[model samples]
Target: MIFVRLCLNTIVRRWNSTELTKVQMPAIMHLTRLGYTYAVKFHDNQAGEDYVPDTNILIKIFKEQFERLNPDKKDTFNQVLKDIKMELDNDDLGRSFYNRLVSVSPSRLIDFEHPNNNVFHCTAEFTCKRDEDEFRPDITLFVNGLPLTFIEVKKPNNNGGMLAESNRMNNQRFPNKKFRRFINITQLMIFSNNMEYDSEGGIIPIQGVFYCTGSKSKSSFNCFREENKGGEKVAPYNAEYSYKSIDSLVEKRVLTDFNC
Candidate 1:
């Protein structure tokens, strides 16, 4: 009887360690707590090569924010978006996009001064297509409707953990020209397996969360660490963030038995 119980517990533990359960859902939940509005779509198909901006959402948010920021400019929303899209198409590694994000262009894309004036959106399974290629990120974070960052989550204690994921992105994903627009628009990429760095390694990430500004270099992977001035470590969970329905949602969606 005890052996059967232990086996059941082991199965549950393994089941709970899935990428979606261990990291993706929790990340989305945390983002929602951090003031990001959850963006949901019934289908995974987001149209266009530069679906990073999800043109529809971009237009909606841009019009509202742009008109508010540049109140003197009348009916120039379309022109501004067109110019921004042109800049994005001609830019490299999202450099132009980043500029528009931080500073005011001929037109304003995001209100960096009043952060609350900008829209923060978070979504998962963000699928974007470019000709014959389709890249679906595990989680995509949007600022003012532009997908500036995305996260890739892996099952904990997987084959190579963080290193394997980094290699896959740099070797398989980045080199594909079909992903050129996607890569150009995305400013940051984060990877995690819900574990700490416990392996002996020089610079290669073996575990824990790491982020890089696009895949400019394979060696750009850097671990994320937060410490206060007092030398005490700070953690995300240490913050008091909660939602009334989050517990129930996690139980129903994250922890629920797929077999059942």
Candidate 2:
């Protein structure tokens, strides 16, 4: 957890972003009309009142992208979300979702990259619920009010392995489950520890083939093995995997439509 925090803080200090600690998911769900306006229909626990927005800002972005992805079809936020969910529901076409996500134009990132852009928000130990059950990831990243990446941190040595733990979190733990509505909208999935790291979703695989939903661990996961395959030393897909701390890796670049 410390290592991940170090990386996050490094990026936060270097880039035009803000990191919030001791924040609840409800607070993060609603945007205060600063850098980005998500306008999500968040259940307001603040002031013990109810607040519902008419449109989801992130979903609106998706709707625009979907319209661009299919110019012939008329797009609505609900239909756009349902279409992505349909592709997401299919195990074989998981990478299609990643392709579409990355294909989103940089303009849609929403006033990012400026000195006061403030589109990216990072929080530690945020609680999210799937129906009545709740889980807290080590870190949750929000881009323009969209909770895009979820990071699960662990100790050096735990259960089966980092891969096993990541698989459990990615596929079993409220994720890919109907009740966990939040996970359905999430694009990037990551798991890390001091000794090992793995990331999936959001970005396409270097090998050019993404993992099937049913085959989560097979081709999708990229680990920092650095082993020699066929007498050639293999490197992690993204150089950031090898980097202890870098501004462009997970934070600045992933949020933008740079196609890294």
Identify the candidate with maximal TM-score: 1
The reply for model 1, stretches above 4 Å from the true place, is 1-17, 42-57, 201-203, 216-219, 229-260
Cα lDDT tens digits for candidate 2, 112-220: 2343533455554545553456666555666644566666554434454455654565566644343234454466666544442323353422222111222333324
Deviation of model 2 at 223, angstroms: 1.7
TM-score of each: 0.77, 0.41
lDDT digits (tens) for residues 1-260 of candidate 1: 99999999988867655655667677777776677767664253444322333322344555666788778874887776666666656537667766776777567767777788888877777675656677788888888777778898877787887778888888877777667667767878888888877666575558888898765445368877664455435455444346435445543442232221
The number of clashing residue pairs in each candidate reads: 0, 0
Score residue 113 of candidate 2 by CA lDDT.
36
